[model samples]
Target: MSPANPFTRRKDRIDELAATAASPSGGIAEAGAVDEKPGVSLIASAWSRLKRSPVFLLGAGITLVFVVLALVSPLIAPHDPAAGLLLDQVRPQSNPVPGPQDGFPLGADSRGRDLLSRLLVGSQQTLIVGVFATITGLAGGLSLGILAGAFGGWVDALVMRVVDVMLSIPSLLLAFSIAAVAARPSQVTVIIAVAAVQVPVFARLLRGSMLAQRSSDHVVAARALGVTERAIVFRHMLPNSLAPVIVQSTLVLAVSIIDAAALSFLGLGNPNDRQPEWGQMLGRAQTYIYDYPHLAIYPALCIIVVALGFTLMGESLREALDPKSRR
Candidate 1:
């Protein structure tokens, strides 16, 4: 056979090598194909991180328990929450069963109402007020923070100054003042007060997060690509900054519950005397402290336990969300 040209022979050998490299058994080629689906791999990596986080598991557990409690209280309560059984007034306390005078397992209040039932019902009110207030505060604060950070001039100064003013005053005093000034201590007024007090805290947190995010490479790239200011601020920066905000919001819910109870204890919430609020129950129980301590004790304990649960969840969420804590 005639000898192939030198260049052509070299080309044939290269082609053979290329074909071999394209085969499935080629380790480098197989690895390159595997790298194509990065999104799926990224999600799996995130799930792995979540699974490793003890704080995340604990927070999720606490949140689930409370959600179940709120949903099943009606079915779980042993007695009618609104019914007053006079025969069950001031019964002796027992763990397993209600005494003859006990309206329910938790004993009766001064009004002969079931303490257990009232607590079950009161949980709904606490959750409603806390959740709505936190949502309102988050929305308002996030808006202000985004505007301040994105604009970074007069707008920033104005928003920060307002936050400073709010923070200067004691939060409880501010809530109390707002509640007292309202025409009536309706649930709406209580919600508004709680949200108002929370706004400054949320604003500060978001503003700080936004300041850090504004300098990030992705944000800079988005800006360079001519993304609209609003879109860059909201769609791009907001989502990335939400981890800390979510953690803060969890703590804020617990704080809101405590604030609402304080407002009610000061006679600035749930206008009706018969309304079964934990704080209001405590207030009423004061009159029967000597004769029936269980009235106050039961409600107080319920508040303590519920607050403790939320506090633990908040701490867990904070630790889970914090990068430093993870490290």
Candidate 2:
């Protein structure tokens, strides 16, 4: 063959270069392109954000301490919570309650029981009520929400109307009413009342979340794929709808603790002094409120601190989960 012109050879080379550049992976685009990053899931991303938040750290710390104390109270407590060891030192006409004495670092309640021991032991009861109440509420809420979200139509309307009615009543008042309706006032009664009060809130929140998820792309695709309605609702929609509910449960923990205390304070909780609860202790302290402020101070402070911890953690979780808050 005749030798190709140098200019023709150069043009052919340029054309080849142009074609390569025009291809998908070429030229300035290819040179500037960065490696694709691995996907970060919502849970992991939210957790990463939570780890960096001072509020979350503080809240988690406080909650952890409270939980540890509650778990180890029987082992760590100095005296029997129900024992009236200091009864000899208390005189109704003279000293209504004792100040920090020999073995009683936090003094003693009017009943002559060790305040510190009562406080420590009380944590167990407080945790039980709070956690149980939240679980009960969550279970009830999830059932109603799923029914409404999945069935729609009459099911949705019926559930929403009931929720609205419940919401219209003040939560505390509703709790009181429910507790009163019970055959007797006890720890069980307190849990039932608090859970009932929380049910509406959780139900409404979950129903709304699931409803939003129903129209999501994944849910629609699942439906188009002929996935069973139950599978789509529980497997796909429910999981995606749970972020808000999880955060709400933390906040509800705080509320349930406070509600349980309120019930005990109002003489609607466990009446047995042998099983000391923060609210029960606080209830007994009411008579000595003016003379010995410490009687109520200790339990009250504990309730406040623990509740604040849950509130802070819940708020932090909310911020972390919020897409708007993400960088």
Candidate 3:
């Protein structure tokens, strides 16, 4: 105590300061902890960015509403979608769209079916066509892309030439021709038709993406290491090349929805008035369009809104994934 050890005192002070700095409120520790946190993956980062984007929000919101509407239609819808006035279930007489007094807020069709109910139930079909068409196209396209991209040489050229030939024709026309020839007009026919339209687009996109990825350092390394070509292409290249294809698939959903609707409107979809398909609804509406424009407007508006939602989502995803497009 006579002369406090200067070094000991200094050491005590340092220890005390270090304890404080290591406490819950230490600024340096907080900063260091943050720095030590794991970095986000490209997909996670893209998702985070997409969540922050108003465009993504809008698109997702619209699509979600339709999805919800479709899923819970039986509960939320005002009336049985198939409930019609005529003996044949065709509302050929109820062209007089009624008020809510009859439980039809959105009005009635020529078959006297609740327009609102039909519209609500129609969401299911619309989504079905869109989803199924997307799946069909993606399956076919992925196969072709992988085959062509992995094989190269004549296989690539052959596949690409076929794709090119298909691409040369208008997508809708090709779909229409296929639908007309292969099957009877219905949801299945329409689905196949729309999927056929999308096949070339997906095939080309995935093929290009795979080709680009093939030249990447990782791919080359795998090749150098004697990895099987199948393993390299399927395991390594395919996964990396999927980003663009995924983005394109989103955009394609919008196109598929629109195309499905077009086919229905053109009489290639379900013709039964009882079947509530947006496109079919539009087709049936043509009969009473002059008397009740709402008939045409409702289905058209639904198609437009749903398609817009997918389009927005696709575009937003594309921009989020592409660093060059980020603001």
Compare the candidates by lDDT and give the number of the best one.
Answer: 2
lDDT of 1 at 59: 58
User: Candidate 1, 111: how far from true, in Å?
Assistant: 1.5
Candidate 2 structure quality by residue, lDDT tens digits, 240-315: 8888999999999999999999999999999898999999888888898998988888899999999999999999
Q: What is the C-alpha lDDT of each candidate?
A: 0.77, 0.92, 0.85
Model 3 whole-model lDDT (C-alpha atoms)? 0.85
lDDT of 1 at 300: 81
**Would you list the rank order by TM-score, best first?**
2, 3, 1
Best candidate, TM-score: 2
**Candidates ranked, most accurate by lDDT first:** 2, 3, 1
Query: Mind sharing the TM-score for model 2?
Result: 0.91
TM-score of each: 0.79, 0.91, 0.85
Give residue 15's error in model 2 in angstroms.
Answer: 7.7
Model 1, which residues run further than 4 Å from truth?
A: 1-59, 87-103
List, residue by residue over 146-252, the lDDT tens digit for candidate 1. 87777888989999999999999999999999998998788889999999999988888888888899999999999999999889988988888877888788888
lDDT of 3 by residue, 1-327 (tens): 498799999999999889978899887677677545788888899999999999999999998998999888878888888876432444345524553345666766665667788888899888999999999999999999988888889999999999999999998899889888855677888888888888888889889988898889999999999999989988999998899898999899999999999888888887676668898888877867787788899899999999999999999999989998887
